[model samples]
Target: MSHRQYAVTHTDIEKLNARLLSISLSRDERDWQSVFHTHHFTELFFVVSGEGNFLFREKLYHIKTGDLVIIPPYMEHTEQSIPDTPLEYYVIGVDGISFQPAGEQTCVQVFCNVSNKALVEEIFSQMLYEMRNPAYGSDKICQDLLEILILRIIRSQHVIPVPIASTYMTKECARIKEYLDSNYSEPITLDTLTDLTHMNKYYMAHSFAKYTGKSPIQYLNDRRMQAACTLLRDTDHSISAISASVGFSSQSYFTQAFRKKYGMTPIRYRQSQAGDDAANGS
Candidate 1:
Protein backbone atom coordinates (compact mmCIF):
# COMPACT_ATOMS: atom_id res chain seq x y z
CA MET A 1 0.00 0.00 0.00
CA SER A 2 1.21 3.41 -0.94
CA HIS A 3 0.49 6.28 1.48
CA ARG A 4 1.10 9.96 1.18
CA GLN A 5 1.04 12.34 4.12
CA TYR A 6 0.04 15.91 3.61
CA ALA A 7 1.21 18.60 5.96
CA VAL A 8 -1.43 20.94 7.35
CA THR A 9 -0.86 24.64 7.72
CA HIS A 10 -2.64 27.19 9.87
CA THR A 11 -3.56 29.27 6.84
CA ASP A 12 -5.18 26.21 5.26
CA ILE A 13 -7.91 26.09 7.86
CA GLU A 14 -8.47 29.45 9.48
CA LYS A 15 -10.70 29.55 12.50
CA LEU A 16 -14.28 30.70 11.88
CA ASN A 17 -15.71 32.83 14.64
CA ALA A 18 -19.32 32.85 13.44
CA ARG A 19 -22.17 31.60 15.57
CA LEU A 20 -25.64 30.39 14.61
CA LEU A 21 -28.45 32.64 15.69
CA SER A 22 -31.51 30.86 14.30
CA ILE A 23 -32.86 28.70 11.49
CA SER A 24 -36.37 28.06 10.24
CA LEU A 25 -38.14 26.59 7.28
CA SER A 26 -40.89 28.77 5.89
CA ARG A 27 -43.82 28.15 3.57
CA ASP A 28 -45.92 30.92 2.11
CA GLU A 29 -49.48 29.91 1.46
CA ARG A 30 -52.17 31.87 -0.32
CA ASP A 31 -52.25 35.59 0.46
CA TRP A 32 -49.05 35.37 2.42
CA GLN A 33 -47.48 38.65 3.29
CA SER A 34 -43.82 39.45 3.85
CA VAL A 35 -42.61 42.70 5.34
CA PHE A 36 -39.41 44.50 4.49
CA HIS A 37 -37.05 44.05 7.40
CA THR A 38 -33.45 44.25 8.53
CA HIS A 39 -31.29 42.14 10.78
CA HIS A 40 -28.16 42.91 12.73
CA PHE A 41 -26.77 39.53 11.70
CA THR A 42 -26.16 38.00 8.31
CA GLU A 43 -29.05 36.02 6.84
CA LEU A 44 -28.75 33.18 4.34
CA PHE A 45 -31.99 32.57 2.44
CA PHE A 46 -32.12 29.33 0.47
CA VAL A 47 -35.10 28.80 -1.77
CA VAL A 48 -36.26 25.19 -1.64
CA SER A 49 -39.13 25.20 -4.09
CA GLY A 50 -41.65 27.34 -5.96
CA GLU A 51 -41.03 30.73 -7.53
CA GLY A 52 -40.87 34.15 -5.92
CA ASN A 53 -39.27 37.55 -5.96
CA PHE A 54 -36.75 38.96 -3.51
CA LEU A 55 -37.20 42.65 -2.87
CA PHE A 56 -33.91 44.34 -2.00
CA ARG A 57 -32.50 47.79 -2.54
CA GLU A 58 -35.81 48.93 -4.04
CA LYS A 59 -35.56 46.27 -6.75
CA LEU A 60 -37.08 42.86 -7.36
CA TYR A 61 -34.89 39.84 -8.02
CA HIS A 62 -36.51 36.69 -9.38
CA ILE A 63 -35.74 33.72 -7.14
CA LYS A 64 -36.55 30.06 -7.72
CA THR A 65 -35.43 26.67 -6.56
CA GLY A 66 -31.73 26.41 -5.68
CA ASP A 67 -31.29 30.14 -5.33
CA LEU A 68 -29.25 31.36 -2.37
CA VAL A 69 -29.33 34.96 -1.23
CA ILE A 70 -26.99 36.42 1.36
CA ILE A 71 -28.28 39.57 3.03
CA PRO A 72 -25.84 41.60 5.08
CA PRO A 73 -26.73 43.36 8.28
CA TYR A 74 -28.98 46.44 8.22
CA MET A 75 -30.07 45.82 4.63
CA GLU A 76 -33.78 46.21 3.95
CA HIS A 77 -35.34 43.24 2.17
CA THR A 78 -38.37 40.99 1.82
CA GLU A 79 -39.68 38.14 -0.31
CA GLN A 80 -43.06 37.47 -1.92
CA SER A 81 -44.50 34.49 -3.74
CA ILE A 82 -46.46 34.18 -6.95
CA PRO A 83 -50.21 33.64 -6.64
CA ASP A 84 -50.46 29.86 -6.97
CA THR A 85 -46.78 29.08 -6.78
CA PRO A 86 -46.09 29.74 -3.15
CA LEU A 87 -42.51 30.01 -1.91
CA GLU A 88 -40.93 27.46 0.42
CA TYR A 89 -37.53 28.24 1.80
CA TYR A 90 -35.10 28.18 4.71
CA VAL A 91 -33.74 31.23 6.47
CA ILE A 92 -30.50 30.81 8.42
CA GLY A 93 -29.49 33.67 10.67
CA VAL A 94 -25.83 33.81 11.66
CA ASP A 95 -24.20 36.31 13.94
CA GLY A 96 -20.58 37.52 13.81
CA ILE A 97 -20.14 36.97 10.08
CA SER A 98 -21.00 38.64 6.78
CA PHE A 99 -20.23 37.74 3.19
CA GLN A 100 -18.30 39.88 0.74
CA PRO A 101 -17.69 38.95 -2.85
CA ALA A 102 -14.34 39.50 -4.46
CA GLY A 103 -13.71 43.00 -5.82
CA GLU A 104 -17.06 44.27 -4.55
CA GLN A 105 -17.76 46.75 -1.82
CA THR A 106 -21.38 45.67 -1.43
CA CYS A 107 -21.98 42.75 0.89
CA VAL A 108 -25.22 41.48 -0.63
CA GLN A 109 -24.84 38.47 -2.90
CA VAL A 110 -27.21 36.15 -4.74
CA PHE A 111 -26.15 32.83 -6.19
CA CYS A 112 -28.63 31.26 -8.58
CA ASN A 113 -28.87 27.54 -9.31
CA VAL A 114 -26.05 26.77 -6.93
CA SER A 115 -23.75 23.99 -8.01
CA ASN A 116 -24.20 21.87 -4.88
CA LYS A 117 -27.93 21.97 -4.53
CA ALA A 118 -28.27 18.50 -3.11
CA LEU A 119 -25.58 19.06 -0.51
CA VAL A 120 -27.06 22.39 0.50
CA GLU A 121 -30.50 20.82 0.86
CA GLU A 122 -29.11 18.01 2.95
CA ILE A 123 -27.35 20.42 5.30
CA PHE A 124 -30.51 22.43 5.81
CA SER A 125 -32.62 19.31 6.28
CA GLN A 126 -30.29 17.98 8.91
CA MET A 127 -30.19 21.30 10.70
CA LEU A 128 -33.98 21.49 10.73
CA TYR A 129 -34.19 17.99 12.09
CA GLU A 130 -31.73 18.77 14.81
CA MET A 131 -33.60 21.93 15.74
CA ARG A 132 -36.93 20.12 15.93
CA ASN A 133 -35.50 17.21 17.86
CA PRO A 134 -32.93 18.46 20.25
CA ALA A 135 -30.79 16.26 22.44
CA TYR A 136 -27.48 16.46 24.21
CA GLY A 137 -25.03 18.54 22.23
CA SER A 138 -27.65 19.41 19.62
CA ASP A 139 -26.94 23.08 19.94
CA LYS A 140 -23.27 22.44 19.44
CA ILE A 141 -24.07 20.19 16.52
CA CYS A 142 -26.16 22.90 14.94
CA GLN A 143 -23.39 25.42 15.41
CA ASP A 144 -20.87 23.10 13.79
CA LEU A 145 -23.25 22.46 10.92
CA LEU A 146 -23.62 26.21 10.49
CA GLU A 147 -19.89 26.52 10.16
CA ILE A 148 -19.85 23.83 7.52
CA LEU A 149 -22.64 25.56 5.66
CA ILE A 150 -20.82 28.87 5.70
CA LEU A 151 -17.58 27.30 4.59
CA ARG A 152 -19.26 25.40 1.79
CA ILE A 153 -20.99 28.56 0.63
CA ILE A 154 -17.74 30.43 0.63
CA ARG A 155 -15.86 27.73 -1.21
CA SER A 156 -18.49 27.02 -3.83
CA GLN A 157 -19.65 30.59 -4.35
CA HIS A 158 -16.23 32.23 -4.09
CA VAL A 159 -17.21 34.75 -1.44
CA ILE A 160 -15.31 35.87 1.64
CA PRO A 161 -16.76 35.83 5.12
CA VAL A 162 -15.98 38.85 7.25
CA PRO A 163 -16.51 39.17 10.96
CA ILE A 164 -19.14 41.64 12.08
CA ALA A 165 -18.86 44.10 14.97
CA SER A 166 -22.00 44.98 16.87
CA THR A 167 -22.40 48.33 18.62
CA TYR A 168 -25.05 49.54 21.05
CA MET A 169 -26.58 52.05 18.66
CA THR A 170 -26.53 49.60 15.77
CA LYS A 171 -28.19 46.90 17.81
CA GLU A 172 -30.82 49.27 19.11
CA CYS A 173 -31.62 50.56 15.63
CA ALA A 174 -31.84 47.07 14.32
CA ARG A 175 -34.21 46.09 17.10
CA ILE A 176 -36.50 49.04 16.42
CA LYS A 177 -36.38 48.46 12.68
CA GLU A 178 -37.20 44.80 13.07
CA TYR A 179 -40.11 45.66 15.35
CA LEU A 180 -41.49 48.17 12.88
CA ASP A 181 -41.05 45.80 9.99
CA SER A 182 -42.86 42.94 11.65
CA ASN A 183 -45.63 45.07 13.16
CA TYR A 184 -46.21 47.83 10.66
CA SER A 185 -49.85 46.88 10.28
CA GLU A 186 -50.55 47.62 13.92
CA PRO A 187 -51.43 51.11 15.02
CA ILE A 188 -48.23 52.75 16.22
CA THR A 189 -47.25 56.20 17.42
CA LEU A 190 -44.26 58.02 18.89
CA ASP A 191 -45.30 56.93 22.34
CA THR A 192 -45.47 53.33 21.19
CA LEU A 193 -41.96 53.52 19.78
CA THR A 194 -40.65 55.27 22.86
CA ASP A 195 -42.06 52.53 25.02
CA LEU A 196 -40.52 49.87 22.82
CA THR A 197 -37.00 51.33 22.71
CA HIS A 198 -37.13 52.87 26.18
CA MET A 199 -35.46 56.02 24.88
CA ASN A 200 -36.71 59.58 24.73
CA LYS A 201 -38.94 60.09 21.72
CA TYR A 202 -36.82 62.80 20.15
CA TYR A 203 -33.51 61.00 20.67
CA MET A 204 -34.89 57.71 19.46
CA ALA A 205 -36.34 59.37 16.40
CA HIS A 206 -33.06 61.12 15.68
CA SER A 207 -31.01 57.96 16.09
CA PHE A 208 -33.33 55.90 13.91
CA ALA A 209 -33.38 58.56 11.24
CA LYS A 210 -29.62 58.85 11.35
CA TYR A 211 -29.26 55.18 10.54
CA THR A 212 -32.25 54.63 8.18
CA GLY A 213 -32.59 58.14 6.74
CA LYS A 214 -36.35 58.11 7.50
CA SER A 215 -38.10 59.03 10.71
CA PRO A 216 -39.99 56.30 12.54
CA ILE A 217 -43.40 57.37 11.29
CA GLN A 218 -42.12 57.93 7.80
CA TYR A 219 -40.54 54.52 7.76
CA LEU A 220 -43.77 52.91 8.90
CA ASN A 221 -45.80 54.66 6.21
CA ASP A 222 -43.27 53.72 3.55
CA ARG A 223 -43.31 50.10 4.63
CA ARG A 224 -47.09 50.11 4.43
CA MET A 225 -46.94 51.62 0.96
CA GLN A 226 -44.44 49.00 -0.17
CA ALA A 227 -46.78 46.23 0.90
CA ALA A 228 -49.66 48.02 -0.79
CA CYS A 229 -47.74 48.12 -4.05
CA THR A 230 -47.09 44.40 -3.90
CA LEU A 231 -50.73 43.59 -3.24
CA LEU A 232 -51.94 45.84 -6.05
CA ARG A 233 -49.54 44.27 -8.51
CA ASP A 234 -49.94 40.62 -7.56
CA THR A 235 -53.48 40.26 -6.20
CA ASP A 236 -56.96 41.27 -7.34
CA HIS A 237 -57.94 42.54 -3.92
CA SER A 238 -60.09 45.65 -3.89
CA ILE A 239 -58.63 49.01 -2.98
CA SER A 240 -60.60 49.08 0.28
CA ALA A 241 -59.54 45.57 1.20
CA ILE A 242 -55.92 46.21 0.39
CA SER A 243 -55.94 49.50 2.26
CA ALA A 244 -57.32 47.94 5.42
CA SER A 245 -55.00 44.99 5.13
CA VAL A 246 -51.98 47.25 5.01
CA GLY A 247 -52.88 49.37 8.08
CA PHE A 248 -54.83 52.21 6.52
CA SER A 249 -58.39 52.39 7.85
CA SER A 250 -59.49 54.87 5.19
CA GLN A 251 -59.59 53.88 1.52
CA SER A 252 -59.55 57.57 0.49
CA TYR A 253 -56.47 58.21 2.56
CA PHE A 254 -54.73 55.16 1.15
CA THR A 255 -55.55 56.26 -2.35
CA GLN A 256 -54.19 59.74 -1.65
CA ALA A 257 -50.97 58.28 -0.26
CA PHE A 258 -50.64 55.90 -3.17
CA ARG A 259 -51.17 58.69 -5.65
CA LYS A 260 -48.60 60.87 -3.97
CA LYS A 261 -46.06 58.04 -3.96
CA TYR A 262 -46.73 56.71 -7.46
CA GLY A 263 -48.11 59.78 -9.24
CA MET A 264 -51.30 57.79 -9.96
CA THR A 265 -54.31 56.48 -8.12
CA PRO A 266 -54.21 52.93 -6.81
CA ILE A 267 -56.52 51.71 -9.53
CA ARG A 268 -54.56 53.55 -12.19
CA TYR A 269 -51.32 52.14 -10.84
CA ARG A 270 -52.70 48.63 -11.09
CA GLN A 271 -53.85 49.26 -14.62
CA SER A 272 -50.47 50.58 -15.60
CA GLN A 273 -48.73 47.55 -14.14
CA ALA A 274 -51.11 45.27 -16.04
CA GLY A 275 -50.48 47.21 -19.22
CA ASP A 276 -46.75 46.90 -18.71
CA ASP A 277 -47.02 43.15 -18.10
CA ALA A 278 -49.09 42.65 -21.22
CA ALA A 279 -46.78 44.78 -23.32
CA ASN A 280 -43.83 42.69 -22.15
CA GLY A 281 -45.78 39.38 -22.47
CA SER A 282 -45.13 38.58 -18.83
Candidate 2:
Protein backbone atom coordinates (compact mmCIF):
# COMPACT_ATOMS: atom_id res chain seq x y z
CA MET A 1 0.00 0.00 0.00
CA SER A 2 1.10 3.55 -0.73
CA HIS A 3 2.04 5.56 2.33
CA ARG A 4 0.15 8.70 3.31
CA GLN A 5 0.62 11.16 6.14
CA TYR A 6 -1.87 13.05 8.32
CA ALA A 7 -1.31 15.85 10.81
CA VAL A 8 -3.42 15.12 13.83
CA THR A 9 -4.05 17.15 16.97
CA HIS A 10 -6.03 16.95 20.20
CA THR A 11 -8.40 19.67 19.05
CA ASP A 12 -9.01 17.87 15.79
CA ILE A 13 -9.90 14.71 17.68
CA GLU A 14 -12.23 16.61 20.00
CA LYS A 15 -14.04 18.23 17.09
CA LEU A 16 -14.88 14.91 15.51
CA ASN A 17 -18.46 13.83 16.23
CA ALA A 18 -17.73 10.12 15.85
CA ARG A 19 -20.26 7.68 17.25
CA LEU A 20 -20.01 4.08 18.34
CA LEU A 21 -22.42 1.51 16.91
CA SER A 22 -21.44 -1.74 18.64
CA ILE A 23 -18.55 -3.61 20.17
CA SER A 24 -18.20 -7.37 19.89
CA LEU A 25 -15.47 -9.79 20.96
CA SER A 26 -15.20 -13.35 19.76
CA ARG A 27 -12.96 -16.26 20.68
CA ASP A 28 -13.16 -19.05 18.15
CA GLU A 29 -12.35 -22.50 19.51
CA ARG A 30 -13.02 -24.56 16.38
CA ASP A 31 -12.09 -24.10 12.74
CA TRP A 32 -14.90 -22.17 11.11
CA GLN A 33 -15.95 -19.72 8.44
CA SER A 34 -18.19 -16.71 8.65
CA VAL A 35 -20.78 -15.88 6.01
CA PHE A 36 -20.00 -12.86 3.93
CA HIS A 37 -21.20 -9.79 5.74
CA THR A 38 -21.50 -6.12 4.97
CA HIS A 39 -22.51 -3.09 6.98
CA HIS A 40 -23.70 0.45 6.47
CA PHE A 41 -21.33 1.58 9.22
CA THR A 42 -17.55 1.31 9.21
CA GLU A 43 -15.91 -1.56 11.05
CA LEU A 44 -12.42 -1.57 12.58
CA PHE A 45 -11.35 -5.11 13.41
CA PHE A 46 -8.22 -5.98 15.40
CA VAL A 47 -6.87 -9.50 15.38
CA VAL A 48 -5.88 -10.21 18.94
CA SER A 49 -5.11 -13.89 18.39
CA GLY A 50 -4.70 -16.66 15.81
CA GLU A 51 -3.56 -16.89 12.21
CA GLY A 52 -6.01 -17.34 9.37
CA ASN A 53 -7.24 -16.38 5.91
CA PHE A 54 -9.12 -13.09 6.04
CA LEU A 55 -11.40 -12.63 3.04
CA PHE A 56 -12.25 -9.14 1.95
CA ARG A 57 -14.71 -8.97 -0.93
CA GLU A 58 -13.25 -12.01 -2.73
CA LYS A 59 -9.54 -11.52 -2.21
CA LEU A 60 -7.87 -13.35 0.64
CA TYR A 61 -5.13 -12.15 2.97
CA HIS A 62 -3.18 -14.43 5.26
CA ILE A 63 -3.40 -12.66 8.62
CA LYS A 64 -2.31 -13.36 12.15
CA THR A 65 -2.38 -11.85 15.60
CA GLY A 66 -1.24 -8.23 15.92
CA ASP A 67 -2.56 -7.50 12.41
CA LEU A 68 -5.27 -4.82 12.28
CA VAL A 69 -7.74 -4.37 9.43
CA ILE A 70 -10.04 -1.43 8.76
CA ILE A 71 -13.04 -2.08 6.54
CA PRO A 72 -15.29 0.76 5.57
CA PRO A 73 -19.04 0.55 5.04
CA TYR A 74 -20.45 -1.77 2.35
CA MET A 75 -17.21 -3.75 2.04
CA GLU A 76 -18.15 -7.39 2.22
CA HIS A 77 -15.67 -9.50 4.17
CA THR A 78 -15.41 -12.86 5.94
CA GLU A 79 -12.83 -15.02 7.66
CA GLN A 80 -11.92 -18.69 7.99
CA SER A 81 -9.86 -20.18 10.79
CA ILE A 82 -6.85 -22.37 10.13
CA PRO A 83 -7.09 -25.80 11.69
CA ASP A 84 -5.85 -25.93 15.30
CA THR A 85 -5.49 -22.15 15.30
CA PRO A 86 -8.75 -20.28 15.67
CA LEU A 87 -8.90 -16.46 15.92
CA GLU A 88 -9.80 -14.23 18.81
CA TYR A 89 -10.56 -10.64 17.86
CA TYR A 90 -12.60 -7.52 18.46
CA VAL A 91 -14.88 -5.74 16.03
CA ILE A 92 -15.71 -2.09 16.65
CA GLY A 93 -18.44 -0.49 14.57
CA VAL A 94 -18.86 3.25 14.25
CA ASP A 95 -21.02 5.82 12.48
CA GLY A 96 -21.73 9.59 12.27
CA ILE A 97 -18.25 10.31 10.87
CA SER A 98 -15.74 8.97 8.40
CA PHE A 99 -12.07 8.39 9.24
CA GLN A 100 -11.08 11.92 8.32
CA PRO A 101 -7.51 12.38 9.55
CA ALA A 102 -6.16 15.88 10.13
CA GLY A 103 -4.25 16.67 6.96
CA GLU A 104 -5.42 15.73 3.45
CA GLN A 105 -8.29 13.27 3.17
CA THR A 106 -6.05 10.67 1.61
CA CYS A 107 -6.79 6.98 1.34
CA VAL A 108 -6.36 5.12 4.61
CA GLN A 109 -4.01 2.14 4.79
CA VAL A 110 -6.20 -0.87 5.51
CA PHE A 111 -3.70 -3.14 7.22
CA CYS A 112 -1.27 -2.25 10.01
CA ASN A 113 1.17 -4.47 11.85
CA VAL A 114 0.76 -3.40 15.43
CA SER A 115 3.80 -3.86 17.65
CA ASN A 116 2.02 -3.18 20.92
CA LYS A 117 -0.66 -5.83 21.19
CA ALA A 118 -1.06 -5.39 24.91
CA LEU A 119 -1.98 -1.72 24.54
CA VAL A 120 -4.49 -2.53 21.81
CA GLU A 121 -6.02 -5.30 23.86
CA GLU A 122 -6.25 -3.15 26.94
CA ILE A 123 -8.05 -0.33 25.16
CA PHE A 124 -10.51 -2.71 23.50
CA SER A 125 -11.09 -4.53 26.75
CA GLN A 126 -11.82 -1.27 28.48
CA MET A 127 -14.25 -0.34 25.74
CA LEU A 128 -16.01 -3.67 26.15
CA TYR A 129 -16.09 -3.22 29.88
CA GLU A 130 -17.74 0.16 29.54
CA MET A 131 -20.20 -1.23 27.01
CA ARG A 132 -21.29 -4.06 29.28
CA ASN A 133 -22.01 -1.86 32.30
CA PRO A 134 -23.49 1.52 31.57
CA ALA A 135 -23.03 4.31 34.11
CA TYR A 136 -24.46 7.81 34.26
CA GLY A 137 -22.04 9.05 31.59
CA SER A 138 -20.98 5.73 30.15
CA ASP A 139 -22.37 6.54 26.73
CA LYS A 140 -20.35 9.72 26.49
CA ILE A 141 -17.27 8.03 27.89
CA CYS A 142 -17.58 5.15 25.48
CA GLN A 143 -18.14 7.57 22.61
CA ASP A 144 -14.94 9.37 23.49
CA LEU A 145 -13.17 6.04 23.81
CA LEU A 146 -14.41 5.08 20.37
CA GLU A 147 -12.88 8.24 19.02
CA ILE A 148 -9.65 7.27 20.76
CA LEU A 149 -9.88 3.91 19.01
CA ILE A 150 -10.20 5.65 15.66
CA LEU A 151 -7.23 7.82 16.52
CA ARG A 152 -5.28 4.71 17.42
CA ILE A 153 -6.07 3.29 14.00
CA ILE A 154 -4.87 6.47 12.37
CA ARG A 155 -1.71 6.43 14.44
CA SER A 156 -0.96 2.84 13.39
CA GLN A 157 -1.44 3.65 9.71
CA HIS A 158 1.58 5.89 9.58
CA VAL A 159 5.29 5.54 10.37
CA ILE A 160 5.89 8.38 12.76
CA PRO A 161 9.20 8.66 14.53
CA VAL A 162 9.00 8.88 18.25
CA PRO A 163 10.85 11.85 19.67
CA ILE A 164 13.92 11.22 21.78
CA ALA A 165 15.75 13.29 24.37
CA SER A 166 17.48 15.16 21.57
CA THR A 167 16.14 15.86 18.05
CA TYR A 168 19.59 15.48 16.47
CA MET A 169 19.94 12.07 18.05
CA THR A 170 16.61 10.98 16.61
CA LYS A 171 17.59 12.06 13.11
CA GLU A 172 20.95 10.33 13.35
CA CYS A 173 19.31 7.13 14.54
CA ALA A 174 16.84 7.36 11.68
CA ARG A 175 19.74 7.87 9.30
CA ILE A 176 21.32 4.68 10.62
CA LYS A 177 18.04 2.80 10.11
CA GLU A 178 17.71 4.13 6.57
CA TYR A 179 21.27 3.17 5.80
CA LEU A 180 20.78 -0.35 7.10
CA ASP A 181 17.45 -0.64 5.28
CA SER A 182 19.09 0.20 1.97
CA ASN A 183 22.36 -1.65 2.52
CA TYR A 184 21.47 -4.79 4.48
CA SER A 185 23.03 -7.12 1.91
CA GLU A 186 26.27 -5.10 1.91
CA PRO A 187 29.08 -5.26 4.41
CA ILE A 188 28.27 -2.86 7.25
CA THR A 189 30.01 -2.12 10.49
CA LEU A 190 29.89 0.29 13.42
CA ASP A 191 32.61 2.35 11.75
CA THR A 192 30.51 2.58 8.57
CA LEU A 193 27.58 4.25 10.36
CA THR A 194 30.00 6.37 12.34
CA ASP A 195 31.69 7.65 9.16
CA LEU A 196 28.37 8.38 7.46
CA THR A 197 27.02 10.25 10.46
CA HIS A 198 30.40 11.84 11.25
CA MET A 199 29.96 10.88 14.85
CA ASN A 200 32.17 8.96 17.22
CA LYS A 201 31.55 5.22 17.20
CA TYR A 202 30.78 5.17 20.89
CA TYR A 203 28.35 8.11 20.61
CA MET A 204 26.72 6.62 17.52
CA ALA A 205 26.17 3.31 19.20
CA HIS A 206 24.83 4.93 22.35
CA SER A 207 22.42 7.27 20.52
CA PHE A 208 21.10 4.57 18.22
CA ALA A 209 20.54 2.15 21.06
CA LYS A 210 18.90 4.83 23.18
CA TYR A 211 16.41 5.80 20.47
CA THR A 212 15.95 2.77 18.19
CA GLY A 213 16.26 0.20 20.99
CA LYS A 214 18.82 -1.84 19.03
CA SER A 215 22.58 -1.56 18.94
CA PRO A 216 24.18 -0.70 15.63
CA ILE A 217 25.32 -4.22 14.79
CA GLN A 218 22.14 -5.81 16.13
CA TYR A 219 20.03 -3.53 13.95
CA LEU A 220 22.08 -4.37 10.92
CA ASN A 221 21.78 -8.05 11.66
CA ASP A 222 18.03 -7.67 12.05
CA ARG A 223 17.69 -6.22 8.59
CA ARG A 224 19.85 -8.97 7.15
CA MET A 225 17.85 -11.65 8.93
CA GLN A 226 14.59 -10.24 7.61
CA ALA A 227 15.94 -10.39 4.08
CA ALA A 228 17.15 -13.90 4.73
CA CYS A 229 13.63 -14.91 5.77
CA THR A 230 12.17 -13.65 2.49
CA LEU A 231 14.83 -15.45 0.48
CA LEU A 232 14.41 -18.63 2.48
CA ARG A 233 10.67 -18.69 1.93
CA ASP A 234 10.53 -17.62 -1.70
CA THR A 235 13.74 -18.79 -3.35
CA ASP A 236 15.52 -22.15 -3.77
CA HIS A 237 18.98 -20.88 -2.86
CA SER A 238 21.52 -22.94 -0.98
CA ILE A 239 22.12 -21.95 2.61
CA SER A 240 25.66 -20.86 1.91
CA ALA A 241 24.57 -18.71 -1.04
CA ILE A 242 21.79 -17.15 0.95
CA SER A 243 24.16 -16.41 3.79
CA ALA A 244 26.64 -14.64 1.52
CA SER A 245 23.84 -12.80 -0.25
CA VAL A 246 22.68 -11.38 3.10
CA GLY A 247 26.22 -10.34 4.12
CA PHE A 248 26.77 -13.19 6.53
CA SER A 249 30.42 -14.22 6.61
CA SER A 250 29.65 -17.93 7.03
CA GLN A 251 26.70 -20.27 6.55
CA SER A 252 27.10 -21.73 10.05
CA TYR A 253 26.82 -18.33 11.70
CA PHE A 254 23.76 -17.50 9.62
CA THR A 255 22.17 -20.79 10.58
CA GLN A 256 22.85 -20.13 14.26
CA ALA A 257 21.39 -16.61 14.14
CA PHE A 258 18.35 -17.76 12.15
CA ARG A 259 17.69 -20.59 14.56
CA LYS A 260 18.15 -18.27 17.55
CA LYS A 261 15.62 -15.74 16.21
CA TYR A 262 13.06 -18.20 14.72
CA GLY A 263 13.61 -21.33 16.86
CA MET A 264 14.05 -23.33 13.62
CA THR A 265 16.60 -23.72 10.86
CA PRO A 266 16.07 -21.93 7.57
CA ILE A 267 15.30 -25.25 5.88
CA ARG A 268 12.69 -26.03 8.50
CA TYR A 269 11.09 -22.64 8.08
CA ARG A 270 10.93 -23.15 4.34
CA GLN A 271 9.43 -26.58 4.71
CA SER A 272 6.89 -25.29 7.21
CA GLN A 273 5.83 -22.49 4.88
CA ALA A 274 5.53 -24.98 2.05
CA GLY A 275 3.45 -27.24 4.25
CA ASP A 276 1.18 -24.35 5.14
CA ASP A 277 0.70 -23.49 1.49
CA ALA A 278 -0.18 -27.05 0.69
CA ALA A 279 -2.63 -27.33 3.56
CA ASN A 280 -4.26 -24.02 2.62
CA GLY A 281 -4.46 -25.18 -1.01
CA SER A 282 -3.14 -21.83 -2.07
Clashing pairs in 2: none
TM-score of each: 0.62, 0.49
Off by over 4 Å in 2: 1-14, 31-33, 100-109, 159-282
- Overall lDDT per candidate, in order of appearance: 0.84, 0.74
lDDT of 2 by residue, 110-194 (tens): 6767778788888888888988998788888878777676667667665222111222235677678777877988988898998
What's the distance in Å from true for residue 178, model 1? 8.8
What digit string (tens of lDDT, one per residue) describes model 1 on residues 1-282? 999999976656777789888999999976555876777778889999999899884678999998989888788889999878888999999888787787655466556458989899889888999999999989999999998988888888788777675221366677888888889888889899888878899999988886566899899999999888889999999999999999997999999988998799999989999999999999
What value does the lDDT take at residue 256 in candidate 1?
92
